[model samples]
Target: MTTRTLPMTEPATGLPDRITIYEVGPRDGLQNEKSVVPVEVKAEFVRRLVDAGLQTIELTSFVPAAWVPQLGDAEELLDLLGPVAAGQARPVLVPNERGLDRALDKGVKAIAVFGSATETFARKNLNRSVAESLAMFEPVVRGALDAGAWVRGYVSMCFGDPWEGPVPVEQVVDVCARLMDLGCDQLSIGDTIGVGTPGHVSRLLEALEGAGIGADQVGVHFHDTYGQALSNTMTALAHGVRVVDASTGGLGGCPYAKSATGNLATEDLVWALDGLGIEHGADLDALVETSVWMAQQLGRPSPSRVVKALAGA
Candidate 1:
């Protein structure tokens, strides 16, 4: 793969010129939580996320209710989004054609497809081999494209897996290449177990570049288990990647990777970006407040280090 170390981002600058915060509070953030967030609350939370100026929100997953009862309200939640705001994009997660059909039935204009980078993960997590899962999604992607929907491909455990040691850079890039070739508008690479360091992140992105995926077509999904999400984010930004995945209050942990935490907090990402002059329109105070409200609704304190620090509770 084509890999290169990128120049560092100057700490003095504020947030970047424009940043797209893909809010996963509903799907990725909620799927792994022990307590169930009421359907109405989830819907209101989604509306709140949009009201908070988040332009792209990953709403919910169309996975079977039997698999993820927490997201059983996907259809109801999608209905509550009302309509796409002037410039916002609402994307939902789909596991296959059945899931995509459910999402499309709700008229979702953008959708995300989930896959794994490792064969073991693919088999254990999705009940299929890596190639088998990708092949299954072929018709789904083609159908979504034909329906004029923007499709995003997700490669989970891009860096490491709980069952596996350090994931090879080549494996990550290869899966990414397959997804990108399937007419996916974007590919989100996830650090499922949060075991990556800034240097590892740099190397991975460099590999994607070598694999012919442009920085703009790539998105980063990080968990804060190692407390290095922000630093690795810096590495991602330096390589010209534009999108990031964060959840409100750091809502859910990685289900497969035992003891793993949830995604990086939106507040932390926005804080770091704000300090970099990156110009993300996310309201840190409001986002933190949203986290506080959701945490209270969930009858717990937020897991986000940034949210906890800001709440001063």
Candidate 2:
């Protein structure tokens, strides 16, 4: 295949050529590993991702250290990154007001709040009902937005859940609406257990459209548990979704969802986008190298097909 040098902002595809790839490897990816990753290594991991041209990276989480010791160094990590400017979008995951406060104190410009579309997941992950969880985020989201910080809302299990099975589209739409009402700048619909097919992805987007949620403010996060992540992402792109959440080297899994697996690998997503002539402003070779280096740090080979293929190539 010949690589074309077309303008990034104006691809031949009707879809928006330049998509924002929100990299979540530093926080979501490393959080699932049982081995305690050193904070220095985690910071270095973030630096590498940025060098690979990732504009928005979820740096870390501000949850209780007791709950997620892996990201307990969130403050230190932010300090290491220094002040993040607008458009860079280094959002940290905040579980509550305290977490939001911590992020604000660090001069962080963006943050993400996690919500679940299923009651069981909400109860297990947040210790609150679906409505209660959204309510808890109300103050957090409001506070962040009032402080002029960008807020992103994540609705997990939008397609299916291991425990609850197929999640209702209506439930997801309502939850996303609440998040939007709470002042989230963007909503990332998630297929946490990766059971979503392309059809499911289209239907969910259609349902969201009917509920007045445009694809511009929507992003998709998919795990590759059943190998549908890339296909689902293509469906999302076709629906005009321009933001995607991916993990480097196919890293990350929900600690709460025991059966969940790797996130849509950054390399895989970039490869598909590259082949499609869509612009993501990423250096594919650099991304592959970063994944390979991070895999060495984790003492494992990358699970991404693109990563493995690139190494052999």
Candidate 3:
């Protein structure tokens, strides 16, 4: 059966005319899986995403197998992807210098470094204080930039932390500025625990702008734990953010933050953007089909509302 079409466009004012949906289903979405996905399946998944018109898909991370065994086939997966990985903005997450080296050796042209907005998370996730983590990332970011590759810096737990509740906006801004100073081309602010509200999202974006980090160079990554991911994304778009990070079937959460849930689903995001009359070059039917297939592979129904509704699952 053919999938359904999206809602008719109703353009929203004060939002960017076009939006870039940075697809993370292949990397962030599958990272926390209990069982590893076959590299061949991962290659097909990426190929399907590219065919679905997602121009920027994060392929995988170069972290050690002991860290995230789910993505241990990173090199093999890339080798399988071959030219498919070359045609689009395929960014990989690199935890440190060694991760960066592996990605570079694989001819990766885009890389992202993950950072924490709270000290507790920094220690828990990176085993280092915030200062120490940033220091370590400095050279990694510089090296990627020198190699003429694009670098993205992710600031996690931007709104609230599991250990340290209600993170101050200024604290997030400081970390964001530091990441940018380290030569990151873009920064993706993450509500890692999904405890953020629209007001909180606005305050954080405004504070970042005040700190000289404009929405043009920023992206928003939200989780659906609190059922606020879509609303928070709308708030960011209203503030002029053009890049959004989403997983294909609402497929990922932070392993470090137990409270975190699945990410903002790409099908859900596309549905909202279509309703808002924004230009995001994704094929809704294609995305829903991909999510449905992936959900079958994972032995569960897709959590994406749009995918379920459209696929009639």
Candidate 4:
């Protein structure tokens, strides 16, 4: 319910002076954890994120409980967040029509469908080829749009895949275009294995731009496995990307990539934005507190450098 924007002009480098940091801690962060976090805890996690001025939170996923048992309490968590009525946008990840149905039944106002840019990743994650998986999502995307829900499309392994190395930028651009043409209101390009560098990020965005896909419709998701997430994010910003996906406490990894590390920490992103004179509207101290609280819940130290430094660990 708080105003998330500040008045600023677009810079000479084409970056928006203000950016929207899409918080994905509750969903992507916790889904990969081995422990089954309590539903009440997940509810509170989202509540605290809202309190920290994260207006857009990826709350949960509607995947099969058999696959991701940690998020089995999706409905209960949503119910708990309902009473706040804070008008923060809570978007859930739905893998297929069945998952979309579960989300729509719960009155989900926005949903995201995930796809991969490479065949190997698609097979490993969704048990289907890239083409076939996108085929499956067509109907799911149509259904969500028909139900008057906002749709976001996620293309994983945009830069590198675990099984297949260094994906071609042209292939990534083609797949992203397909998602956009399939009616996704926005497309989140993911560096699933955390292997992207600033040059790679710049090339991908330039490819997308060459293909007539504007940065306005694209968001970037990066992991800090190689410690390049923030640097790559800065590259994206210089190219006009305004939305970036980050997880609180640096939690989350690709379940398919065993060596992959946690996501780009929200605290680290806030720190960078603060120093750059950019506006993201997040409270860094509050976010660090949330990370500390979550690290305790997970029974591990947070992977974020900022969190560790601020926590004086």
Highest TM-score: give the candidate number.
Answer: 3
lDDT of 3 by residue, 1-313 (tens): 9655658888878988899999989998998888999888899999999999999999999999988899998899988888544457999999999999999999999999999999999999899999999999999999999999999999999999999999999888999999899999999999999999999999999999999999999999999998999999999999999999999999999889989989999999999998988899999989999999999899999999998898876
The candidate with the higher lDDT, 2 or 3, is 3
Q: Against the true structure, what is each candidate's TM-score?
A: 0.94, 0.95, 0.97, 0.94
1 against 3, candidate with superior lDDT: 3
Write candidate 1's Cα lDDT for 1-313 as tens digits: 9543222455553324776888898888888877667888998888778778788888888988887888888888877667777678889988889998898888889999989999888987789999999999899999999999999999998889887788999988999999889999999999888888989998989888888998899889998888888788888887788898889788767556675787888988887776666777787778888998888888889888778777863
| lDDT tens per residue, model 4, 1-313 | 8553322433344556799999999998988888899998898899889889999999999998887888888888988878435566889999999999999999998999889999988898899998999899999999999999999999999989878898999999999998888999999999988999999999999999998889998899999989999999999999899999999999998777786788999999988887677889999888999999988888989999888877763
Q: Please identify which of the two predictions, 1 or 4, would achieve the higher TM-score against the true structure.
A: 4
Q: lDDT of each prediction vs. the true structure? A: 0.84, 0.90, 0.93, 0.89
| Worst ten in a row by lDDT for model 4 | 4-13
Q: Estimate candidate 3's alpha-carbon lDDT, on a 0 to 1 scale.
A: 0.93
TM-score of 3: 0.97
- Scored against the true structure, residue 129 in model 3 reaches a CA lDDT of 96
Task: Please list the residue runs of candidate 1 whose C-alpha ends up more than 4 Å from where it truly belongs after superposition.
Answer: 1-16
Q: How accurate is candidate 1 locally (lDDT)?
A: 0.84
Which runs of model 4 end up more than 4 angstroms from their true locations? 1-14, 83-87
Candidate 4 lands at a TM-score of 0.94
- Which ten-residue region of model 2 has the weakest summed lDDT? 4-13
